[model samples]
Target chain A: MVRRSREPVLWAMFSGGGMIAALLLPATVAVLWIAAPLGWVEAPSYEGLRLLFLHPIGRLSLFAVATLSFFHWAHRFRYTVYDGLQLYHLSQLIAILTYSIAVALTVIAGFVLVTTG
Target chain B: MAKALNAGYKRHYPKWHRERVPIFWWLRSASYVKFMFRELTSLFVAYAAGLLLVQAWVLGQGAAAHARLLNWLSHPAVVTWHVILLATLLFHTVTWLNLTPQALVLRLGRWRVPKTVVWAGHYAAWLVLSLVIVCLFVGVA
Candidate 1:
């Protein structure tokens, strides 16, 4: 019996993350980092943002984007180390480290999202 | 007799050797450099997500902490870094969306959707999503 490789699952997450990042990250970065800071757009007040996060939908969407983006980073960074650094000998270690970091961050993000208003 | 001869010949052959690819091989080609740049965008994507997590955590810490975060974000150096981050993110968005038509093939009954149309559809969706997010954050303030 052949043991299935988990590459497909990781690849699916990476693909989804890439799609989400593409569709969402631009405006997010623009608004949060650039426009709001530069006063080109009004920044969301602390109270306003907190109220937004208090809603289930906002928390869920934020969690989904952050989690998927991290997985995307893990998958891509795994390969970047493999091919870019030519560390094929340490492939298993790299895979474990990257995915573990993503999972750990996901847990932290989830905890914060759940506990916070 | 032929099998015996072939087996003996194989025993005398040297092991195959493959040349090691240099770590900076991608830098040698324009397209390879572009590919590496695209791959490197994952770092910024991860950074953005991590920043969001931090922001959420700060939000939970109370308004003083959140205000501190906002002040930090508004600093000249930090804003400069964000400008660079935004450029890389837009690059990621454009390259990722451009590749979508190739990855996803759309069909309507017997007719295949043109790649241009598929490509345009993704861009349209992206624009709408960007608008939605911008409104959610900016308009509400």
Candidate 2:
């Protein structure tokens, strides 16, 4: 019933890729928290995955972080817009447009990483 | 049978005041607890970025660069920042985990998991995961 009910437009923003990004964030942080002090590798680098940080894996990681982060902000911001701005006519539209840009920017970042790599 | 009173309870309600207001009320509501968590979660953004910078420098110069980055991070100012950011991030992560169920559409048969269960499960998972990670680090060290 809850699912079938008209979900608050703000809630919809979280579902399509936004939720995925939110879920990804903590996992990535946990990984960083673990990877950093543990001396997982003898030396880290900027090169490719095998070589260092500046590599493909690093670039991919950067893009992933940025993309996910944006989506998280987008979803949360939608709620803020909804509650703060009493412009009922425009709230839903703003939410949609915000999420659209967030996803689009995320995609572009992904493209950049893959192409560059 | 209950009699319908024409007048509303007690005193007449005061007229609503009109003026432009600030967003501060948004921060004070109980529901804002979730928003606070979501807002605070942005720390992960900084965490990831910081890690990338360290790795970037390290990768660009090899071992020496990596070592220097580590040393830089160890500075008192940087350490203080890391400590504060780390605390904020963990709180956000934990709160987000707690709220995941409400945000998600999960059902078992006709019954949905209680929000309490959902929140507790997240805390349990986090505890288990963090413990395991800490153990691995300790073992390696």
Candidate 3:
């Protein structure tokens, strides 16, 4: 019997994350890091931003993006190391480490999102 | 009888081995280099998500902590880093969207959607989503 490869599941996450990052990260980074700090856009008051994040929808969206993005990183970085670095001998170890880190970060992000006001 | 006669074939035959690829092979071609850079964009993606997570964590700490994060972001070095991040992210976006037509083949009944149309649609969606995010941040929405 052939064991099923889990690559498809990881690839799905990778593509989904890539899509979300492509669609959202540019504007998010531009607004938060560039425009807001430079006074090109009105920066949200800390209280206002906090209240938004404290809302359930805000928390859910943040969690979704952060978690998917991390998984995207894990899948890509795993292949980068495997092929780019030619570390085929350590494939199993690399897969484990990359996905584990992604999962760990997701947990931390979830906790922060849940606890934050 | 044939199986018994061929039982020692493995011992007589030489093993086949794959040619080793050079570690820096991606540097040899422009396209390969671009692909490597595209893969490298994942790091920036992770960085952006991690930064947002940190921001959320800081927001929970207190107003002073959140303010400190904003102040830190305004520093020259950090701002420069973010500029690089934005560039890399845009590269990722363009490359990813360009590949969408290949990955997704749309059919309108018997007529297939034109690749150009599919490609343009992705770009349009990307533009709209980006605008939406910007509007959210700017409190326009």
Ranking by lDDT: 1, 3, 2
DockQ of every model listed? 0.76, 0.22, 0.69
Candidate 2 per-residue lDDT, tens place, B100-125, comes to 77776657999988887877776676
Give the alpha carbon lDDT tens digit for every residue of A1-117 in model 2.
545643454355344334333344444444344344344533223232323234566576567566656666677666666666555568879778867877776676665555542
Per-residue CA lDDT of candidate 1, range A1-117, in tens? 999999999999999999999999889889988899899987888777876665688789889999999999999999998999999899999999999999998999899899885
Worst 10 residues of 2 chain A by lDDT: A41-50
Of the two candidates 2 and 3, the one with more favorable TM-score, higher being better, is 3
- Model 1, runs deviating above 4 Å: B1-14
Model 3: per-residue lDDT, tens digit, A1-117? 999989899999999999999988999999989888878889977877776666688788889899999999999999999889999999999999999999999999988998775
Q: Could you tell me which residue pairs clash in candidate 2?
A: A45-A52, A45-A53, A45-B59, A46-A53, A46-A54, A46-B59, A47-A54, A47-A55, A48-A55
Misplaced by over 4 Å in model 3 are: B1-10
Q: What is the interface RMSD of each candidate, in Å?
A: 1.1, 5.7, 1.8
User: What clash pairs does model 1 have?
Assistant: none
Question: Better model by DockQ, 2 or 3?
Answer: 3
Residue A49's lDDT in candidate 3: 73
Error of 2 at B31 (Å): 7.1
True contacts kept of each: 0.84, 0.12, 0.78
